[model samples]
Target: MTLSLTAQDKNTLRTAAYGAVSLIAAADATGSPHKIATHGSIALASATGPVGHVLAEKSKIAGLDGKTVAELADHVLPALTAAMNLLREQDPAQAETFRSTVGIALDAGVGARKGEPGPALTEMRRKISTALDAA
Candidate 1:
């Protein structure tokens, strides 16, 4: 299916996808944040379909520079909902792909840890999942 997304829409998608990785990475207080980010980003980059193409773009995802995790969430969570809503409007299947892509990225980040994720990591994951499901 041909998907139509504006530049702003693309920005929202990129921000939501990449921002999710950043969120999970930030949640890893003790573990290797960089490693989590790397794995999560790779998962996002590996996404398929139109969602993959949009996320694979190198364009800047602004508003992800918040110093605090809360600040970052303020910017990202809404984008997640927005991106999902936009895609589902055009194509539900593509929306599912986008959701799966983001979920996998989160898993990659969380899985980077040696053992079970810490409380913060788990909570942050819950928040991200809640945001994704909000749409």
Candidate 2:
């Protein structure tokens, strides 16, 4: 049987995934808010450019091999999150832009997953939101 998800369900999943992943990403990162802010900003700048495209390409390549969306999400989410975390730690302003970019990417990924953001993108969004809140 095939199951379908509504748009609200997809967005809710994305939000939850992002919140959980951000907590994990931030686990080892602790310091004054300023330091955290600096780090997050840098991380954002570094990730803002190509990470999203890379993940989308990866997803497309994986799909060609008949990989499940779940498989693709599992593989891509951590790399995306880690890259963004690094950017967030280095530059907060850029981090904000990156977060917004992730949101857009997540919107796209949701369609790929049949209205749900893939696990990786969802998780990445969580981390992005957390870093933004921190800044």
lDDT to native, each model? 0.91, 0.38
**Candidate 1 all-Cα RMSD:** 0.8
- The C-alpha local distance difference test score for the whole of candidate 2 amounts to 0.38
Q: Model 1: runs farther than 4 Å from truth?
A: none
Q: What overall lDDT, based on C-alpha atoms, would model 1 receive against the true structure?
A: 0.91
Q: Give the range where candidate 1 is weakest over 10 consecutive residues by summed lDDT.
A: 108-117
How far residue 89's Cα lies from its native spot in candidate 1, in Å, is 0.2
User: For model 1, what is the error of residue 110's alpha carbon versus the real structure, in angstroms, after optimal superposition?
Assistant: 1.4
lDDT of 2 by residue, 81-107 (tens): 544454456554444555565555333
**Candidate 1: Cα lDDT at 3:** 89
